[model samples]
Target chain A: MDICKRRLMKELSTAEKGLPSGLTLVSANDLTSWYIDITVDSNSLYQGQIYRLMFMYSPNYPMKVPNVQFVPDENRPIPIHPHIYANGHICLDILGDGWTPVQNTVSVCLSIQSMLAGNHTNERPPDNDSYVRSAPKYAQDSRFIYHDDSV
Target chain B: MPETETYHSETIYPVIASDIAMQGTKTIDSLNRLVDYSSLDYIDVPGHLLCPICQYPFVNPYTTKCGHTFCKECLIQALEPNVDLSVECRCPIDRRPLNRDYVEDIFPAPKIISNMVNDLVAYCPNKSRGCQFQDQRWLLQRHIKDVCDYALISCGGIKEDGSVCSQPTHRKFIMEERRIQRDYLLYGYSMLPPTNARLMYGSSNIHTKNNIKDSASSSESVETKDKSNSLKFDQPSKNNLHLNAIKDTKLYQKLASQDDMPLLELQEDIQIPCVHQESDCANGCGIKITKATKEAHNNIGCTKVMLSCEYCELQVAKPKLNLHFEQCPEMTISCSAKAYGCTWIGIRRDLEAEHQSKCHFIAMVPFLSKQDKKIELLEKENKSLRYHLDNISQSLANLPSFGNINRNDSVSSDSTTYSIETTESLGALPVLPVDLSMTNASISHMLMENDRLRADLDHLTTSLAELEMKQNTLFMQENFRNQEVMHSIKGMINTLRQQIHYILLEHRAFTTNSSNPVHIINQSSKVASTNPELLRRRLSDITRQDVKL
Candidate 1:
């Protein structure tokens, strides 16, 4: 019990220290889960866009990577483009095949914003629905598949 | 719980437990306006006379008790039940103790039947629902009592029960207010009542009740004005007429009457130009400036001031006139505040900035760094376009030189074979001696060199992808951390709310106590604990950091 408390306390204090700018931590109405809205420099395609990424820490976090989902909703107030689905589901590999324990909600959002700033293909997968539901369900150090770099 | 203010029954409560404050001359007559006086139905008090001997409603109209056939209270008093009474009880039959336990303790009649065709209550007052009243006030007393729910009372601001109406009822009253409005409507000015004259609604409340003891006891009578079902006051005029409703004798027709202010005594406090030398006095607040002063205002330096209130009319005044406004109650009111398009009239004491902060037309907070962002986006798009154009141009240039070899059949045929050959053979071409053949040397070098370059490019692309993949994973973990902190803060707030609830419960006991500074201090601290600003700021910072990440 003490260990869990200490770990969460440390995470909270760190989040407090980093929030001077626009970093926000949105906990589920219940304390069971939380998500962060990864914002990019508004100058980019992802600017003014808030890419929501959820972090599901196990009753044991950090020791293992928390389960994460880049809950992109195109229906959100954020502007839509080719790369982002209307559902806000991001096609970035880091949230999928490139999943790793070391990754966190902030890094994933930054990666997506950067990913958007550098790519041009706006189309979703031919089977976008299936892809979202059936992509590798867990982060297990899958080999990363990076394709486009040109913005 | 507050008393229902049922129009029939009254409940008195003491708010200031210490020395009373000015005896609060407010006599609020909350008549149930939703009541259909047109239908004329009720089972409340003052609806009937009681028998003097039995203290129940009068029956058989016998003059036996003191030879007076009044309600029981009258005859009971005549009996000199108490030692102070001067009258004696004389039974009509014998003049004994009047003790006829012979059915004496019971209701006298088996039934009463007047056919009530002319009486008002055969149908339920809740005419919307169809329950017949079956009897009069005394018989239906237990049934029509507030708990039974057939009672229909409503305020203009509230629905059928003084709560905001979810459904609307379209009904209006023909009140004295309508008559007074007729005066203003016809004359363009509200004439003051004659000295020693009373407003009209007073008489309406006095005699409007059908048949009851409303005047059964009082010797003195006062009258003159007001509507039976509705009361009226001049709509923000300089002239005023007052209303007075004597309590205990009668009640107003509806509960909506409670919201109207009884300015009979303090009418001047709200209506007269007691400020600014009364030079500006006219139909408007405080007073109006003279024509010369108007010229001065239109040309001379002036400070713009605005005052607004939900319940008052708008007024505009000058700051130079501040000295004259010190004693003016309406100074706190509108000061020519036309900018807001508000026509509220009130004193500065009540019209604070609270009204302005909530104005719907106020502008929203601007987007942060909007210009810098637009510039940054333009620059980034420019850079990407430049790189893309350069890439296409480089490919175009490569096609042209290769075009030369393709047009020359000798090289074209050989290149065609180069593309189709087995992978092992394509790069295994012999290195021709430089002195032996120029075309052959060029072809061999170009093919082998092309293979090596393709291999190197593949490796670099693969590495770049890995780096991007890592960046995304890191972002997901960071989001998880922030969520944890928000929950902790919310939990703290809920705990504080519970504590405050307990403190409030405890306060009800001490609100009656005269001395208890400690409770006040405790309440203040408990209130302070619930401030969400700290949590809000904390949330702001975390969101910002998440963006940077």
Candidate 2:
């Protein structure tokens, strides 16, 4: 198996045993992509809402940044935030230019969980309509200028 | 001896085989990335065997000062400053500080960890390629490369460069006679037609085909007698067909009486050439291994396989090295402004991000002063040109007769004419040019001469201005020097005045205080040519006479 698959297999097996509260692995059959379901553990705007996070790993995973977005499916809804767009594109730096290789699926999921837990605003990004309409298919493809990091 | 023999074979054989099998089935973990060893049976492994970073069995385990153990590679990666671009080094587990100064002090694999890792049974990494061999975890690489029939081997021909040819096309095969013997003993004897025919009739053909083996097996009958006797340790069943075929042969009955030996003993007798023994032995490490494990020794365990970094000259193991440029501190790298035409080359260590951050040409702002100098020169030229234009316009209005002159003569004159002087003397200058026109047939010729002189005067005045500026600076320097000299002279005059005033005072004291004792002592020194006491008495007598007077 490639390094990505081998590492994913390990991550999957570890997640199979148990994960942090409110964070659960939904589907990880594909080596290149995975879906993780996260529920805000604390009382917040997105407390009970189910949000699915889709991670598309490049061939050079752990070294290159992976494409992460809030994938709104039939059962899952996108988490409202100033940095997150309606099209599921996130302006968070870690998912963009500020990514560190040491970050893995667990860390990324937790970062997203904390991002949702800290949000008080129930709105999309300021330029949500224009950005989503012109956003690339992959979040990594867009040159996102991450200015605010509070949320 | 007979009673002990039964117990040994019955008890030890199964236990030894299973022990080897248990070891063979163990998985060899990779150090390149994180691996989950939790898939393994929890009861069979110790928690300490797992590396904290990869969560897999440690390969080259290391311990930090904090007592946290990790794979050597994982620790190195964690400690790399470029990984997170953070200046502070810290342990991944406890977030404790792991400064670079103490990173080298991290302990090597402990004795217990080394022993356990070496003892673990591991399947060949090439098991997917149909290798069935399993051995000690450390020996799997060799078994796969040297002994496994499925493992590809080099063509072994010498290249023109005197290096071994690296074409991995040849598959190692045991001798046909030996293969037959091994198959018969291990898999129950069977009478295959090819085997019977090769032994009975084709044996002569085999001897002629392989000249190297012809001497070893001189005759087919003699070869079968020796091979069958040595291979008869395993008792064949009554239903065996190969026994029926070879039993009637004369050598078969002679082999049946031979004593039995263990299969492992026979297998142990197989000697495989240490692939790099010839190359490595010249460097003083002459190691000969079994044919099954020679590949692993040369590939993994051989210290002779170290390669020097092209840039830094640091020795690195051949298999573990990636692109050295990424890690070599002394690698030569071009300046970050190479795209902007900077051609500096330096070691990676000396040129930090600061080098690019502070690069002058990259910023393109420092060179603006040079451009400013050029602009100043252009403005000076523009000022002179404006003065010349004003003179030309004023002259054109004054001399209406000058307009009819040939343009060719005016173009032939030098362009550097200083109109400043000529413009001031325009009244007299026009009269001279008009007189020259009367004498010359081409009136433009006189105008050209006048223009050339004016051009020379303009150039001369420009040079004169530069000289004047240099002279001004020189004059200022001399003036400063004179002022310093005058100040020192005034100080000397004051000192001379003070000395003259002191001398006058002393002279007055000698006149006014002649009777005084200290003045008499002074007079005695002046009169030292005479007797000293007499001079003092004479001076006192003179003072008394002067007082009487």
Error of 1 at B211 (Å): 94
lDDT of each candidate versus the true structure: 0.39, 0.55
Ten consecutive residues with minimal summed lDDT in candidate 1 chain B? B269-278
Residue B9, candidate 2: Cα error in Å is 30
Docking level of model 1:
incorrect
- Docking quality (DockQ) for each candidate: 0.01, 0.01
Tens digits of per-residue lDDT for model 1 on A1-151? 2223334444555565674334477664333467776665544444555566666666533323355555645322433444444444444655543433234445555665666556545456455565446555443332234474453
Compared with the true structure, model 2 gives a TM-score of 0.37
Where's the lowest-lDDT run of ten residues in candidate 2 chain B? B9-18
Model 1: per-residue lDDT, tens digit, B449-512?
Answer: 5534544565677788998888878877776777877766666566556546756755753673
lDDT (Cα, tens digit) per residue for candidate 2, span B344-439:
788877667456676776676446556767788667656654555554544433332333233534643333253334433443223354443332
